[model samples]
Target: MLEKVTGLSDLKEILHDKEDEEIVFTNGCFDILHVGHVRYLQEAKAKGDLLVVGINSDESVRQLKGKKRPIVPEMERAEMLAALEMIDYVIIFTELTAKNIISELKPDIYVKGGDYKVNELPEAEVVAEYEGRIELVKEVRGASTTNIVAEISKRY
Candidate 1:
């Protein structure tokens, strides 16, 4: 079973004993788990001791990715992410952006794909405020939900 955390406070208590542990965080819609997502996560986890993923809720995904997005529900997405041995924790947030969660968790390193500019993301400011590191990983081409959806639509 995947361990569930309700809020930020619960998050602190869970890592209280391991303050020195490097916490790497990443957030995304994760509507459909694919090779790109997995590779990105693995790279992020390599830089820290713990990998915490902040998943946008189903509602939030729709707001960002449009109405037809999030082919999978938030719970299912979170559960799938948690199942990966490289992912240490998964938190689902109702917000479209992960700024709130980033501030709350204050992870040692915040990671995003190369698609985003380091200075442009909301999480970037949060990481800056705490003097945390922000890593822009190499993007995986043809590994986006947009392409995935298009492929499915072409088939059916």
Candidate 2:
């Protein structure tokens, strides 16, 4: 499972041989794993032969979610995602958005939670440039790390 966690260059090398497969790509901070994440990933995986997840690096997560965010560290987060049965590959990225990763990977399909609009995504252009399909998985209502954190805080 840990072996599933890899760097971009190495992932590219590995993916190079998988040209015959329909690659599915998705990215997020994944600060704290939850049921919503599991279902989202499973849905993403069903879109293609392989599911590659780009995780936000610790610094990137901080930039996006504020300093006290990312309840889990980057490596731990990557490992957690890699451990998932539906996830074929997991890579940590320092970018705030998935545009660079999407540009480089150019996956057959790009998946995101339905919470985001396709037109609002920065990586949507890159996906379109490569003629890749964009999929939006319906999010599980009331199932999010932010909500979990708030509930924990309120109880504590």
Candidate 3:
């Protein structure tokens, strides 16, 4: 079962073995599940023993993706992510970024897809302070939600 943990208060107990496990953390909109998201998450799981995905809350998605985005609701998105075998836990964030959560979670490693340089990431500093590392996963071309949404709109 994929456990839903919204804040750090519940994570410590849930991830009781985090100190021993490689606890990999990553955050994103994940408004719609897709092949790329699956592949990226699968790869991320391989890098650690436990994979925790932080999904953007509906409000955060609206802020990052604009008002007409997040076709899927927060609960639906969380359920879909939880359905994935690679994902151990799903946390929802309502902020523009997961800096505060990262500080609280203090994951061993943080993963982000695409060509985001370590310095360019907002949470990089905090992760660095905790001696945590951030890795960038290769992005699959023609597999982005934005592109898919655009194509669907064009077809209809």
Off by over 4 Å in 1: 4-6
TM-score for each prediction?
0.95, 0.98, 0.94
Model 3 / residue 150 / CA error / Å: 0.6
How many residue pairs clash in each candidate at the backbone level?
0, 0, 0
Q: Highest lDDT: which candidate?
A: 2
Better by TM-score, candidate 3 or 1: 1
Counting only residues 3 or more apart in sequence or on different chains, how many pairs clash (N, Cα, C under 3 Å) in candidate 2? 0
C-alpha RMSD values across all candidates: 1.2, 0.6, 1.4
- lDDT of each structure? 0.87, 0.94, 0.87
Candidate 2, 27-62: lDDT as tens digits:
998989999999999999999999999999999988
Output the worst ten-in-a-row residue range by lDDT, candidate 2.
Answer: 61-70
Q: What stretches of model 3 exceed 4 Å from their correct place?
A: 2-7
Predicted candidate 1 versus true structure: per-residue lDDT over 1-156, tens digit per residue:
367534567777776767989999898988889999999999999989998888998999999988887899988998888889898888889997899988888899999998889979977877899999999898998898889889989999
lDDT of 3 by residue, 1-156 (tens): 435544566876777756778999999999878999999999899889999999898998998999998999988898899889898888888889989889888889999987678888999999999999898888887888898899999999
